[model samples]
Target chain A: MLKKGIKYTVALILLLIVGYNSVYIKKLSEVKAAAATGKFDATLYAQTFWQEKLTPGLAKANNLPELLTLLKSDKENAFKNYSHALGIGNLRYFLIKGIGKITASNENDISVTLLPDSVGQEVKLATEFVYGNAVRDALGILSINDFSNTMDMNNVSAEINKKIRTEIIPPFRAQAKKSDVVAFTGAIELNQVHLRLDEIEVIPVSLNLIQK
Target chain B: MSPKVFVKEEKAQVQPPTLKAPAFSGSYSRYLVKFQSLIALFILCLIISLLSDKFLTVANGWNVMRQISVNICISVGMTLVVLTAGIDLSVGSVLALCGAITAGLLKFGIELPSQDLFIGFTLLGVVLAGLLTGTLLGTFNGWTITRFKVPPFVATLAVLTIARGLTMLYTKGFPISGLGADFAYIGTGWLLGIPVPVWISGIIVGLAVFLTNKTRLGRYIYAIGGNESAARLSGINISKVKTTVYAIAGGLAAIGGIIVTSRLDSAQPNAGISYELDAIAAVVIGGTSLSGGRGSILGTVQGAIIIGVLNNGLVLLNVSPFWQQVVKGMVILLAVIIDKANSKSE
Candidate 1:
């Protein structure tokens, strides 16, 4: 009877612990999903859009036939292609390939690891776009200001602004435009090009790509 | 048959006997040699005073006191534990755990709804957490030693690793910072021109003295350390008493951790990593036998003061930090040698 009582109590305790953990995990997942769409989500969307622009657009399209013919006949208008046509090709690559590996899912609130391999082999651009000290992350970083002390969001905003301005902004400026040259098998594979002018807006856009 | 005659007869019957001289002089010379710690402390202070100009300064002395305050406080408890032939390697980790719990409680409290309960409950929670954690750990060490019949060294060594690992797990290798202002006052603030830590250490040392000198529980600890089998035969409730000793030691260690964290304004998971070594060294240097029994609180106090002075003097002299460790170890060895030589002669 003593052994039976002990077994029953142990089983009940284990069940309660498991149940509690499951509920806690479910709540955590919900919070993470909600977080993926907030102001922080703007960066994720922009990165996704760049990744989609790379493989699908240029990999499928061929020759700027009309633009090339115009270019062959009139060399003076080539400057227009440089500003308009070349820029479009660069943007497309940036959106499709460059941005894919720049952002990924966060495992926890205070932790994030950028998955560079999501794009392609020899992913150099992905490394440049990601910021944050892996050592400090492991050792843990303290957020300035007590989140509980005041009803003030100013401290949080200040910290976020410092990180964005100091660490994030400069890199974005450098990688803002994408490369016009696309190489496949060690040669420039610029067989086709499509130059599209879309109106720029404050609203963020995400490029969606489905591989064939 | 008058009253005067009766008084005279009683006086004659109660006549005082002539006094005889004591066999030996009650000279302090004998005691001065026995308490070699007092001699070593005097020599150390003299040497430091002669070596450095800044050593005597008020500000620098305060700094030294502040630095060694936690060590001094914890060594008193360690002295008691060692007196019972038990080692407490877990004290350092216990300190870290207590500090982390204090930080966590405060952080959780601050995040809760702003009510009186938040602050009150937070303080209570932190203190209770320290007490509970320390007592639990001490009990575990005691149980392992007594029940499993494991040697105290082996048992406490296991506890040392386990407690440190748990501390790392709790903080995730991070330091918990931004404790409340009031909490910081315990370590940082001063009372009557002395740092609060010094005052706290003084009070604890006094309490430790009273426990070791005045109480039955304290006597039993020394007795058990002196002879375990004898104490057991005398019905001293060996298990319960030993457990209580460890629990007290653990609790005192937790207090040390709290004071240290508050002083630094953070609970670094690795803060108290090697503090236990210094504590043990202090106890041994104080003329306490490592084999257990036969030590005084006064000697340990002197030992702690000697260590505090040596560390302060080294820094004041601007000696290389690496070499300072070598010097300190040599000094401890030297003091132990002096103590042993003195005891043998006695």
Candidate 2:
């Protein structure tokens, strides 16, 4: 009689587990389908985000006054102006394109003064923020404002920046030696304003030697 | 206790029919005992799922499985340890030590040519260091316990603090990072779309089930747990079995440690902090008798899944971290209470 009770109990437990798991499975598929469209497509976000937002925003600023004016008055707008495409903190990145004359080279980092073209003002390019989240925060694309309290965004910033440093910077370093006119699209941060605007730094996302 | 000891001493002069039950047989009585934990797990799952839509999702299912893989791996070995009527509190510390050793070696010590490195013996040093450290620690624990006649609890507790100290001294409390993709694949890679840790744990669980079910060592373990003197009288080497069980437990814990370190792309010296308690909880909640020798891998699996599900569900429900702790403790207490009550009734 006890054995019968044990067998029935086991059976019932197994059935309950199976039933619960099936319900969970159903919910999982729905989330997967929804996530397939957005939220989890990290690579998709990374690849297309630059062309859509950063370049246009960077082209809008011609001089230190314009960049600083934007920075001081509406820090959110300043970040939003750059990240308006994905919205603030939507990405840890973006891309901006501009032509600059290389004035100096520091190994992987090169100092380029922007050539007045679209924005119509020459400004020194600062790569001093090269080592950290200066580029991620400058872009204001990472959606960090959304989760400021809950997480340390440093690791994610490091991860995205590390890829940029290793994969994107090497060739640019070799090509943009002093005196080269370079066309580049890259990620920069407006974060550390204690430094002058051009001296602040842009981590180049992509670079091309427009003229040797 | 005194009357029993006196009766046993008196019985030494005359043969007596000793009342003994099979240590871990799926016998009718033992089945009822195992069933109690299973029922707890099922009830927990059902309630948690009903309360949270996110708890029942596929992504969360994988998340839970991945989260529990380390616990499951260590628990298998813990089950064996408990089956021998012994406890191993050092498994967590051993995990940290081995994880630190392996990651430190890979990230800073070992150098491989950049080309075709993935297919090379790139991970050989990491694996060797982890497994070797695990074995040595296990042997040390065993040596301290068996040779000095130290209690298993005391021996393992001492080793626990020792191993943690060793880890901190070795890593200088820094996380070892930049292990690269090839090494990371051990934990983060997928096999047939399942996380690599899950695959590895699944295989280890299968092997553990086989080892405990199909080997002479398994039966001997049961014998030792059921009654030590009887096992010794039957010519089983108590020292050897205990050492082997500890060694297996340590080695499995190392595998778990390595996988976790690889998943995070780094190993923190503080990894596996308090994790031994989790593995013990898995074993206990699975209906393994703390007294010794009456448990199954199946029960522990249920116990692990229950834990994983509970954690995932609580987070999905957006409960406060403090409240989550309270709820988790209450549920764990409830599961064990039910298990104890059912066992007593039986």
Candidate 3:
């Protein structure tokens, strides 16, 4: 009887271990699936998982899109978030792709190219395509998916507010500059873009001409 | 009973001739734990390298080292704290607070760039600032743990939330920027083809190793960890030792914060969240007993590298971030289970 009891206990333990392993495998598989899809609905998953499992205060406090950016920036952070909310792991792939340009070709529908700028490397649109009668407006559509996520929308609005009020509007209003504009585009617009500078250093030049 | 009968009875029990054998048993067990952990770390690193081409790159290797340095520094101190059966969850938040203060000082030039904020003076002042802040916070934790008899886990957990909240209030939700080029150099620069953060971490690890192996204080730490009541009976100053251990932990965590801020060139008030767990994980993987009294600095360094390689390799392979977490959790769980089995055998 004792031997039989021991066998039963061992079997139970093995079953528990297998169950745990199965759950882990499932979570990992889900994360991988979500990461593969560029347009997966991360917000829905984040909200649902948070509501069902995570602490309510934490769920409500975290700004999902900003947190998504933070996770993609570092692997350790990504793993840490994935361990907590698997939804974060799924969103990070899209977040990184978003940071760079996403290109669509005839066969290769999406590719991203990095460009070196004054500040740092930035993703620029490579395709010459226009949407809704505007060439520059096409860039706006790329970020529209980002805005569709409510959490990301909040971050964008906050950044735009900060730039408009604390940066652009103050200087423009002070100098009475009328033509300054802020546009979100994937590529540079030749004629429509306005240049704004906080300070400029001028160099003096001498030109000598002889007339006959 | 006859002498022959007594001898036969003792032989039947397989009793050793002396108690010294069991005394030596503990050391042997410790050695086994260390060996097993080293083997695990070796296998982990090997697997990661084979799986990802990017893992073996010189630049990526340096980046991994640079990335793990801060966490390792904190783990070195954390190992000591945990050895005394205590914890410091506030390390992460403390790191942010220190970074914020340091960057805030730099932004306004509270000290003049050349005159007052020369390398020697500025660096010294920053170190002192970190030390003071860390020590005070650690001392606060130690005091509550000792005086109020609070559990290390609960007390430190409370401090973690409080410190993070204070950081947000202090920074008003924006990162502190405009640090000096000199300050930024610590994070980005290299010495002898190695990043400064890596060099600094190496020095810190060496110091911890020396302290643990070659000092009387180190002996007491193990003694306290092995058995607190017995250690107190032996006349070790329990409260003082505990306080000092936690203070050192805080100071070490502060150094990590300094390194991170320098690298980013700005101090994000919210940076370093969940850092305590990484430090603890590294310490445990290195074969440190969570219950305290058994660990080594060298082991912790190896553990840190294992985690660093895992992170870097996964990114290089472009493994879905979700799966990476699953893998990490499994590794940690396995390590812990192995550690427990080894402990029981000892």
Supply DockQ values for each candidate. 0.02, 0.03, 0.02
Give lDDT tens digits, candidate 3, residues B176-253. 765667888888898898899999999999999888899978888888998999999999998888888888888888
Clashes of 1: 14
- Give the DockQ-based CAPRI class for model 2: incorrect
Cα error of candidate 3 at position A17, Å: 62
By TM-score rank, best first, the candidates go: 2, 3, 1
Query: What's the lDDT for residue B75 in model 3?
Result: 93
Q: Which stretches in model 2 have alpha-carbon errors above 4 Å?
A: A1-135, A138-212, B1-33, B110-121
lDDT of 2 by residue, B192-241 (tens): 98998999889999998898899999899888998999999999999999
Please provide TM-scores computed only on chain A for all of the candidate models, following their numbering.
0.20, 0.49, 0.23
TM-score of chain B of each: 0.86, 0.86, 0.87
lDDT of 1 at B5: 100
Instruction: Give the Å error, residue B87, model 1.
Output: 1.2
lDDT of 3 by residue, A1-212 (tens): 99999999999998776545322212334444554785435455434433453222222222223433454465465333332211222211111112222222222112322221222232222222211111112112223333333334334333432333343333322422122221212112111112111111100010011111
The numbered model that scores best in lDDT is 2
| Cα lDDT of model 2 by residue, A83-109, tens digit | 333223223333355677887776335
Q: Whole-model Cα lDDT per candidate?
A: 0.63, 0.73, 0.63
- Local lDDT at B246 for model 2: 91
